[model samples]
Target: DARRTPPAETEALLTEEGLGAEFVPARLGGRLTRADLLARALRPVFRRDVALGFGHGIISLFAAGAVWAQGDARQRQEMAGLLLGGGRATILHHELAHANAILRHEFTARQSPDGYRVGGRKDVIINARRAGLQVVYARTEPARGPRSHSVLLLDPARQDTAHLRHLPRVETSGMRGALFSGLEFTDCPVPADALVGSPGDGVGLALRAFQVNRSLICGVVTAAAGTVLHSAVRAATEDRAGPVARRWHKPLAGVFADLLACDAMATVVLRALSLLPASAHVLAAAVKYVVPDLLRENLEELATVLGARGHDHASPEYGALDKLVRDLPVAGLGHAGSASCQAVLVPQLRGLAERSWFVEQEPPPQLFAPRAELPDLDYSLLGIAGGGDFMAASLVASADRTAALRGPGAHLGALAGAFATELRTLREQCRRIPPGAAALNDPAVVRLSDRYARVAGAAAVLGTWEGQDGTDPFLTDPAWAVLALTRTGQRLNIPVPQLPDGVQDTVLGELLRRHREGRSCDLDALAYTP
Candidate 1:
């Protein structure tokens, strides 16, 4: 359906409503000053249509984020003008097979008297055919390392088309309607000013850009899962025979808690992009790796609630479920998939374990506050490794405080303590092992990375609960907190004894209540009308 209409058409409608400004920096005459706010503004679009969201806007954001983070004055102003005009822009970095591994990139921009001539090809690029500006990562020299590559802003409108050609659209299973194409450049010349940042800064800029891209993508995909939860809950609530509702109540409640826990992870990570940019790389990777895996599993479970209706295209409202299930995974693939994200973590575990994982510093309250004001995103501060994780450290401290208290919160506190203990054990093991790139590919390291992600999720949810100021009933309640921690523990294969009686009933009742009231099951403060 997305392919049936031109992406530019839908993009223009969103642009008319100022969606383009959502990706532009506030200083650049745009609305996007904070990552959390950007997610909030785009939530409705992603919820309604993933393809349109990607084709019309998000892919451009990926291209623009790099410039916003590393671009010179001229580059930023140029990008602002292009996006404000509703013109699509995209980043061409790694081939699909490479998954943003810059070392493997074959595209090159050789120096010339006139300027630089770009050569090679880029495929699986969204909006490539229509994008007015393509921010390309090309090898500028024969040398290796971070300095060898340079980022260039290619303006198709200004280029000589004598050798530049747009590759035919490539059809795919999901996001079928977006313009997924390639660009082949044969000595396409451009002015030297097209280079973004300085030569040799491209790799650093890209690594920093990944932190932003991975964080935003995690938030968008999580919102899509929120849409799925809404639809499933609607089906359960409107079940005519009452049997479906009864059968799905407990499962729905468990999944709802999982979504909340996952939402908390994404929420904290996005906020961290601003509050803790120096240490946000690992946190962002944890979010990218963990959140989508949870969503994929949750969607599969949701299929039971939708029954046969999930596959029935005739039921337009609910049938979008099939498309969403197909499309959500696509967002996880482009820049980095789960394996690549985990690969980033495996090597950093040693340093994090030694210095930061269980430290006692209190995270900024803004990280827990949804849509809270944040400091400017400084891309230069973002690193390959954050050296420490304040979220995990804070989680351990908060759980200790709760576990020390006498009362109903103690049980949940103990679960938190158990999670913290597991993390400590993981750190001990990771510290003793060789922290190398080769270790990242090891199965043992992969499993440990997975456990590390679950630990991060538990930490984020507990951190959110501890920071709540009692205004939100569901979030403030220990019941959901207990369920959230318990579910995360279950994911780690930790022992979770049978829940106390009425736990399921109470949680399920709240889930159905939220659904009936048209409220988001995630940490989002807004309610869903449909």
Candidate 2:
């Protein structure tokens, strides 16, 4: 339970496994060919420990994401080489500011006769002390406009040691194994070629990188939630004959459905990064905002099942559950906070409400198919503002298709119709909001954004169900999808119809089967030896 960096042996093992290559592109001589597969590869690490996942190399991947999005060919090759060689890298932001604002960075880099002279301090940086390469965000111009800031790729090995200093490590209540520190540069000179993109492209590059990283990180953290749920299920099964245990069964089934819904949304967003890059910006933001909320709520419900044992760090049976509960919040706050993600959606709502809501074409079925092959990810296609929201369009189309069903799946049509109505209401609300008022400062605007995110999540679930080809029996079953939609409708405060008699039993049975069979709680359903 001690808060410290990951043990040296664990770090060595991760390095030996070449985990860093997951962040590098295959074209650049690394293993990173797809974003969804990268998340799948990182699951074993997150499932074991959130701190180890962060401490080992996620921060390096976060740093490399920006370079992958905007860096030149030489920069990409250099970063790929660094990670492939087991060297660490990190991104230095000025502060934990809102994602939508034009940040006036305190970290500045002044132009000089031959190069730039950097002089500033950035705090709360992950891997700051251990990083050999730093992607520093700094103000290059005097103005406060978007063009004033630039991202500089710095090599501490080449810098003058006397001018650069690493600050003390910052301790946290969770994810304690992560190395959180700061850096200060006093007139450190660097070559002009260190820039990742053209002058003033830092903010744009950062936003695009956030689009990819937010989706990837959220997908990885789902494994941690699954781990906690497994613990709760084990505890509940101990008192199998008790009335309390029986009551917990239905709630446990509900939570499992929530986890599957989260996985569906995250999986679709990750695949969308490659297949539908134009629509990924808003979809990424929505997933980042919604998935954590669902996972956190699931964690809270599971905590009730564990009772006081959930808090006992000394109990070997439940100690990991307590640690995961503490670590879950930290994962939510990383990269972008919930408010920042909602802020990203606020301004785009009006545009989407006007042009894309019901007018756009439905996204291709492959956009939602988890097993389908995708186009190679092109970071160049990642836009700062989404051109359209095909996911929402797909929801409307799915509702129409579901309404035609005549048998056991009939209730899903009503649930899907409720969500479609929710979308139409969201459109009207967005249309009524005054231009430029859809900002973080307005509580109403934030609420609208939240509702929009939930609706988008519903769309993800429906699209996933519709795209399935009966390969996985669990995914193809309508019981889980019905419960998933019902739970979402509850969150939206809509009057959803009562679920069929045996839907809960079917879902509960699957949850128990997965636990007994050593399969993952999420949709991948990969078998394990535990």
Candidate 3:
């Protein structure tokens, strides 16, 4: 009877429409062009129930995507048979401390002529016990650097599950359906082809999987919020209790607004996603960062509406509301979990901030330019022994002031127009510091370290492009990342002395204050202050 409680497996399978045309067709059934749809479906399921969604929902999406997006036809059919046949339920993640299902290993494979064995453990796997199919993400080489990972779908029957039997079962307050556990590979043997992709391509493909996971996490949150809104409406209309009627107005309004906003955002992202083959690291990062707030907001309002009813086990609202509270946090955290997602996002965004090229002019360029000339660029190399040293030092230069970029220059365009904003950011950041502390290498010093790296790279590159190159070069020059980093550094209270007070930097300064001290968001409420 307990097993009959319906994990939504049957229903979701019935709903598996494939990624349709959205996914890149690999061995996996179909592929998703954009990551947003994944989030859209996930939000509802998660809000409905976190544990089941993540535990089972995660595997389903991957199974589907693996077939559609990651799997070659052979892989897809193999997985399709098991999944469509009703036999797979194991998610092996967290064991490696990353959600990177495809990154490779620094350690090389160990083998005898007879066969080879994988000898590490997958730290935290979901639904790990007795799964017929195991989705194992492993490194071909130990310390294979970050990018050398891969995702492999395996038969537990082949590798050793002896370790699985001994893995400790974990207890969680929310999303308990996941049945979390760890794994150990003790002389585990597999055929030579266990590799997911060429070793180096592991991280890239894994990233694809993670993007799907993170985006869908938004759906989980939305669902949680929607459920709250649904319940509040029910209470306001049906419950006769004076308190329920009186207090429901504002909370209900908040939930309703949140739901609408969620839908709008979802639509925008989904449409945008369809146009791309897969979500980029930056786009995925943006979604992961913003959507969590939505989920948290939704759940908090749901809690408020339920109020006294929230605590009573006997109350109809108790189970779902309590579960919602537990589930919402998990979505924010993500599959490999929150902290892991953050580490990945922070760097990816930082890269986007640096590499992007833009100009804020009186009249923005035509609403749509041929997607060709993006951003800006400029660079020129000198006529040296081998080639010309780059001449432009103002807009571009080498890190140590060596190696001038040469011409027929690929990196030059109208992008230098941002010189005005870039200079302002540097000046402001410099102004914030007490004068003498502005070192170029110090991450804390705005313009000195990574902060300056963006602007400096911008200036250096743009300066090099003295004469003729197409307008296209400027569009893609990567000065945006520099400006963005400096600005954020300042806001975080981390000084980017090289660049300061830029609007985005200001936000970073604010964030730093929140991070170092108490977060300014109502300490009394979100903190659950007694």
Candidate 4:
């Protein structure tokens, strides 16, 4: 884009390509890439403008797919022309009130055999007013479980116009100008064909979408973070001539460490991405789990160097940094919050869960990983088990999704049972940890271990089916809620109730026991060298 098109030409390119109806796939007139390239290209765009970059870049995914997924080829072609000829934008069916999943809130078409009116509102919908197309994910409780909800693509011109009001400024601390809108679909009419896929398949389809969204998020976050690191290092260096040089090396070291950490994370994300469909849910969740907090740490650290002026919009040099940091949260929180990403990740811990399906049991580690090595793993685990019960719940989620438990009621039941067992196992393990062996002294280890125990404890305190139907909630994403609790306890490392001494026998303990003592160790022991 930088080579052929002038910087100012971006908007014009959108017009030329008839991108207003972008969410439409090539089958519907838009030129979209396969998943891998799409994920990579998004990185640069995120640096420029997270919201718009995400909005325009993904319109094809959201808007186009919503319609093309549901409509017959002819219907898609007809809509395609309208877009190519220029003047159609599609409404992406996302309920900000929900986890951008398939649970819809408005139901105008249920009673009507072929025609329906959509009522209720969709908040934080991108391109709600501007698009000619609206792919709405209305909540239709279809017998519960995975496929309970469905996507319905609407041409707003045909829906109720009275309630179509643009949302207020509503600026967030992060993700500015993302063009978020609230749509009150009051009695909005919808022809039967507007539905994406089979009548009751919306939520399932959205699950696939979520997977894609998660992977794409990693790419974007990776690129933007790289920019931050580059800038920070430059700022730390360029003053070589100054007498303050004696202290300069320390700052350079921090910058270097941050850079190395970022590089390692980038490699981790790629390895995860390469794992693909089989690994998508967990690996993408892991990257989404760690990257944002990384940026937050770097940004906070960089700010100290730039001083109080880093926060000042008045300083041209620092303003960009401020904006990037402010925008950091969106990427950080979006692909599932860091916590949710972690929760999803807990069950996928390389060996712990692998034992359930594999022929061999993974060997328990004798020596622990170095401090830097622990962050991502622990963050992923800690976020998952906020109170200690997360692992149990994760076990449940795993069991519920298993082949034996695919039926809605059956899955929920299995999930519940597994969750119960998970809590028990963790509690027993927590009890085994010796006293004063660990602490939240390190963010990474605490997040993964001790905090996980706490989350397990909390889950015991709160049953899985306590308040809402396990299958009915979109906000059911187990991130933030779990993260807060897990992060707290992760650092604490106290054992949960039962089995042992109510202490957490952590990786940190093994690491310290060997490394600090200068004892010989295995392959993992060698990786911790500073």
Candidate topping lDDT? 2
Each model's lDDT: 0.77, 0.82, 0.42, 0.43
By TM-score, is 2 or 4 better? 2
Residue by residue across 452-488, what tens digits does model 2's lDDT show?
9999999999998888888888788888989989998
Could you say which candidate leads in TM-score?
2
Per-candidate TM equals 0.94, 0.95, 0.58, 0.58
Better of 1 and 2 by TM-score: 2
Model 4: per-residue Cα lDDT over 321-428, one tens digit each: 676766655433544355455544444332333233223221112101111111111111111121121224333443343325432334233333434454445444
**Candidate 1: which stretches are off by over 4 Å?**
2-10, 95-105, 239-244, 333-336
lDDT of 3 by residue, 1-530 (tens): 12323366544653474322222232233333234444543444454466655555555555444334445556656666565444454545433322333122222235446544556664455566646666555555556466545556667776665532446875555555556566667666666555454444455555555555554555345555555555555445553543235455445544443343344333332332333323233333344554555456566776766666665544554456666666555444434444444444333322233333222111112111222132210000101011111111233322222233333111122234334255446444544443332232244542222333334323322322221134533223323233433333333344333532242333233323332342211101011110
Summed over model 4, clashes come to 49
lDDT of 4 at 261: 33
- Superposition error at 266 for model 4 (Å): 6.5
Lowest lDDT block of 10, candidate 1:
95-104
Tell me the TM-score of model 1.
Answer: 0.94
Deviation in Å, model 4, residue 236 alpha carbon? 2.5
- The TM-score measured for candidate 3 stands at 0.58
Model 3 residue 360 CA deviation (Å) reads 10
Give residue 145's lDDT in candidate 4 (0 to 100).
Answer: 56
Off by over 4 Å in 3: 1-47, 63-70, 95-115, 160-168, 240-248, 331-338, 348-530
lDDT of 1 by residue, 1-530 (tens): 64345565666678799788888888889887677778878888887777888888778888886688788899999999988877789878863211333334468989999779899886567777888898998888787765888899988889888988888877766766666777889988879899888877777777788888877877777777777777787787673755345678666887888878877787788788788888888888888888778877888888988888887756756876788776765655443577778767888877778877776486777778654678976666677755577878777787788888666677777888888789889989888767556787688877888898888888888888877877778777777778877877877888765566666677787777777687777775478666
lDDT of 1: 0.77
